[model samples]
Target: MLPAIVLSVTIARPWREVYEAFWRPEAFPRWASGLSDMALRPDGDSWVGEGPDGAIRVFFTGHNDLGVMDHRVIPDGGAPVHVPLRIIANGEGAEVQLTLFRQPDMDDEMFARDRRWVRKDLATLKALAERG
Candidate 1:
């Protein structure tokens, strides 16, 4: 079985503002801890970046921040996973659903390492948006 964390983050800001920041790959380096650098190219509209292995950039579509990503890790003979984000408009602000799906198969030591990374990342994202 895969262990994953799905969390909801509410930002006390306009939904559009929050969504745009999320869609821009460049904004990731600021909020995403594991990502080194990220950008979107004009040609294929493809996004590129370097992060913890098993992650890929996909142009996000739909009524979201507007980006796509295939950040999934599939075990032997398994299928790819998916992560989804949805922004909801609150009274004068917004909340976000960070849909996470992963097969938690890493060893205990590595699991702890990944958890730390993830925790810091969510915190950073919250701070970045709220502070802006």
Candidate 2:
């Protein structure tokens, strides 16, 4: 199994409200900087966008009652990376969590960098969600 880490941010909003506001594939680029340079456009069952390395295709989990917001990202000519994200109730607020998997080709440094990236993205999400 691959090494993994789960990072999270607490948002001052209802879990359902937060999920409803940003669970779609198009909303990802607003916080997930690593996924898109600008915006993502729908392409069949997935979305296409320009990533740092080039173009990427992303497949997002369908909307449901559960707070699941998982997605699979396929970089141009590269393997797919699965990102597991969720928003769960934390009292009257919500906790947004993301799991980062250390890929087979990743070194300690690479994994650490990705961890930082995720952390920053989560912070951005929190700010966006909490904004008035």
Q: Which residue pairs clash in candidate 2?
A: none
Please provide, for model 1 over 1-132, each residue's C-alpha lDDT reduced to its tens digit, 9 standing for 90 to 100: 556666666779887787777755566668765654454332355454554563445444434443232243232244544555566788788776665544456677776676667667767877888988
**How many residue pairs clash per model?**
8, 0
**Number of colliding residue pairs in model 1:** 8
**Winning model by TM-score:** 2
* Candidate 1 off by > 4 Å: 1-4, 37-45, 54-56, 62-80, 107-116
Model 2 C-alpha lDDT per residue in residues 1-132, reported as the tens digit of each score: 989999999999999999999998888999999999989999999999999889999999999898999999999999999999999999999999999999999999999999999999999999999992
Error of 2 at 128 (Å): 0.5
On lDDT, the leading prediction is 2
Question: Which 10-residue window in model 2 sums to the lowest lDDT?
Answer: 123-132
Residue 89 deviation, candidate 1, in Å? 2.0
